[model samples]
Target: MPKWISLDFGAKYKLSRLKLWFRGDLEYKDGNYPTDWDVYGSNDPNPDGSWDSWTFLHHFDEPYKPSGLPHKQYTQEDIDYARSGIDYEFIAIPEAYRFYRIKFNETTGNGAFIIITEMTYWGKLEE
Candidate 1:
């Protein structure tokens, strides 16, 4: 089983950097990955009707070997760590009118699994 992480955006400021790490062994067959995850933000806690569309940030495999990484950039098991490891990062935090939120959707198999590990909010407090 693999692990995932997320961060929350609020009604104070937009995010600039996001760092994430995946723990545990990951296995992929035929080189197919699920498309999930979204960035959201709003003032209300519920944040209903106030969410951005789902987007693709990054994709990795158990071995981290790209079917054809240009220039042979990434190597197999590039992010594989038996004891400790780090996985992904995002530099551009969407220009949220107010805040930012992260939604993870892992809809791939008959069994649906989506988990949130971390959620941090970065911004100025409202007066």
Candidate 2:
């Protein structure tokens, strides 16, 4: 459910092509409004081994909707909701980052979804 992610290029990364995907509901629990989401560099890990600098690239609130059964995974259904859906949003990382971390504010609540069905991070491999 709640986890951290890292991507190391071992060189440099294209800030503009940074992308991510999540298959299920990413809605935080009650009052768990993430103040901001961040991306950091492992090369610049902090004292706690967490990425440093990790700039705020971008964040989304209810990015996408689905077609067909409105499920978590991608489907072949070409419904209008699918086209207008934004389940995933691309963000530009900083140019100097060698490793990155996606951070979000944590919260707790009953009958809430604290899970990330699926996630992905990819782009033009930097070298």
TM-score of each prediction: 0.41, 0.46
Q: Global CA lDDT of candidate 1, please?
A: 0.37
Residue-by-residue lDDT tens digits, candidate 1, 35-82: 345554454444343234434333422223334443223445442431
Candidate 2 clashes: the total is 5
Q: Per-residue lDDT tens digits of candidate 2, residues 1-127?
A: 2345666667665554333322323332332222234555545655575434456555544323344333233344433343333244455554556766665544233223333433444556566
Q: Which runs in model 1 stand beyond 4 Å of their true positions?
A: 1-11, 27-34, 45-75, 81-99, 107-111, 115-127
Range of the 10 consecutive residues with the lowest summed lDDT in candidate 1:
26-35
Task: Tell me the alpha-carbon RMSD of every candidate.
Answer: 7.2, 7.0
Per-residue lDDT, model 1, residue 35, is: 35
